[model samples]
Target chain A: MLNKVVIILTSILLYKVGGKLSLRSQLLKGILEGCILSIINIQPAYGYELSVKLQQFGLSDVSEGSIYPILLRLQKEKLIIGEMRASESGPKRKYYKLTEKGQEALQLFTHHWTLIKGPVDNIIEQGGKTDGSN
Target chain B: MEATEIIELNNEKRTRLTEHNLKYYEDMLLYIRLNGNKSEQQTEEVLLEMLEHLLQAQEEGKTAEEVFGDDPKAYCKEVVEEIPTEKRKNQASLIMMVILQFLGFFAGSYGILGTALHYFFDIGSALTTFSIGSGLVILGIDLLLLGAFILAILKWIKQSTFSKKEIKSWVEFLQVWAISTAFIGLIVVIHFVMPSFGKEVSIPTYYLAILGVIFYVLSFLMRRKQNF
Candidate 1:
């Protein structure tokens, strides 16, 4: 009986954790385009390479396929341009490079991000303090 | 690369995908391709890029759902929204081509059948009177209904893309049969109910057939020139 109770409780906890991770992904969607632009600003990259880089930078919550729509949007806006280049391992890969417009856009994103990040950080930190004091 | 070249390359690369992944990827392909106003070259280019990404992800043992997300329809919608639309002139030319082709086929078939019945079987008149006003109305109605039918079919196909439940073959057959029957029935009813007005022109069935051939040839030339 005790083992059954522990198993049931553990499953519920795992479910909640899974739900939280999905919620985090939902939140990440808003800033994913900016993140992509910043990465392309660093250096030219392809779709798979961009996803890998994002994962390397601790953005595992963003799905590998999710970056594609953002890439399309960026290309449409003329912020980045994709050119087909030969790859060593396989068929040709479309490498995306940031344009001058993209550079300006990335700088603007950084400014806006800095503005929002500091206040949000302070609020969360102060809210924790108030809870502790209470 | 040209759109045709990209399409050829895509066909070759797609065979490398696992069956499940191919199904997912093809759904996205179809959904994007069905969108008529988008730039064909850009669409094909993006599709090829997507196929490459999927292939790489597959090498790492990741399923399409893992890479593309579970909501394939929503993902496709986002991609479609971002792709550049075709130029207004190109879109107008395409519509004109379709209308011409439709007119050619309808007129050609009707003329041929009427001519055969009149000359070979001694059944009907070789010359028929067509009213300018009613003919235009009928053509307009046919075009509108055909457009609506095509759109509904496309919507149905897109909706089926990530559907969990399998739609039975019989149900699909019945749906297609019903829609086709309704379409034909509506056209026939319109032909009879619409009042004939304006100028009446009497032309031989063979002459009408010749005119249809002319329209068809014009449309074919336009298609070749435009590369649509």
Candidate 2:
């Protein structure tokens, strides 16, 4: 009886949780990923450079693990390229440069965000509630 | 110090850079290597330039540990990743739930293809059975897929890095991709077996089958990359 009750409650809780994870969380991801894209436009950079610039822009939780993989994916997608060299310290140093594909992707992403941002703002302004913008 | 000696000393820990300083060295190394200058003097100049930038970054007032948030130049990912929702869905158990559900959608639907085949052969009458059975099975898979998709979303809601919402959207995207491929598979089945029945099979059916095979391989690669 206890196990049955627990399963029902758990399922209900899970459903409630799942339903809420929608546009907001992904939009946040888009913003951060887009920021990474825009930065790539300025100059080729490394993971640390990205992390640093992101923090300067008021992003606090960015980690090297997340950024490195995104860089790798961007490189794999032909959106970016990695330039590796032997460092004086002995570790291989990799720099990330934006490809034409990356530039095009960034442009499209920025445009999409602009379109979404307006309605999102209107919705939030309708109520003082926000989907965790900070 | 001689170039070789300097490198040896640096390696031996005489020039041990703190984690704080290490990333600076890396960036300068990347800069010098990429900017078409690799002479010792140019390397040294780039290193100094990077070191200065690192110090300047600090003077802007951010701690090393919270640099993702505090540093003016850190990646915004630190901010996005810190979202509380992403953390919950990243758990092995939850990720497993999504993987199982994702696989279950197709695994549960495999029988549909077989049923469709049995009816296609006798097409004189098996048509009713195949149409009815395939439709029902597709319905069940759709429901399961929908339930799991929504569940994946809810699971990722709060965390920044892998918020349940992102998971939900990704699952939804994957499902759409999966269903379309299943239809393509159905078309492929029709091409080989249907051609034997003397009906003119369309050319696009063959083309779609080819595309389906390519996408199947690509999907496998994507799944592997995601560790799904």
For lDDT, the strongest prediction is: 1
Per-residue accuracy of model 1 over A23-105 as CA lDDT, tens digit each: 44434554777788999888899888999999999999777888887788789888899999897786788999999999998
Model 2, span A1-134: residue lDDT tens: 33334333433422333433354433344466678889978987766667778878887665433454355445546787756554455544456788888999899877766765575456546444433442
Candidate 2, residues B1-228: lDDT per residue as tens digits?
A: 223433443444414445754553443233233321123322332233233334444566533333322332233322222222223333443344444544444433443443455556632322222244444455455555555555444333312232214346677678667656665565455434431222223232223334444544555665565443
Q: Grade the docking of candidate 2.
A: incorrect
For each of the candidates, the C-alpha root-mean-square deviation to the true structure, in angstroms, is 7.7, 21.1
True contacts kept of each: 0.89, 0.03
lDDT tens string, model 1, B136-218? Answer: 99989999988877777877676766667889989988887887788889989999999999899998988878778888998
For model 2 chain B, the run of ten residues with the poorest summed lDDT: B77-86
Cα deviation at B82, candidate 2, in Å, is 19
List where candidate 2 sits over 4 angstroms from the true fold.
Answer: A1-26, A85-92, A129-134, B1-228
Q: State which candidate has the highest DockQ.
A: 1
lDDT score for residue B206 of model 1? 81
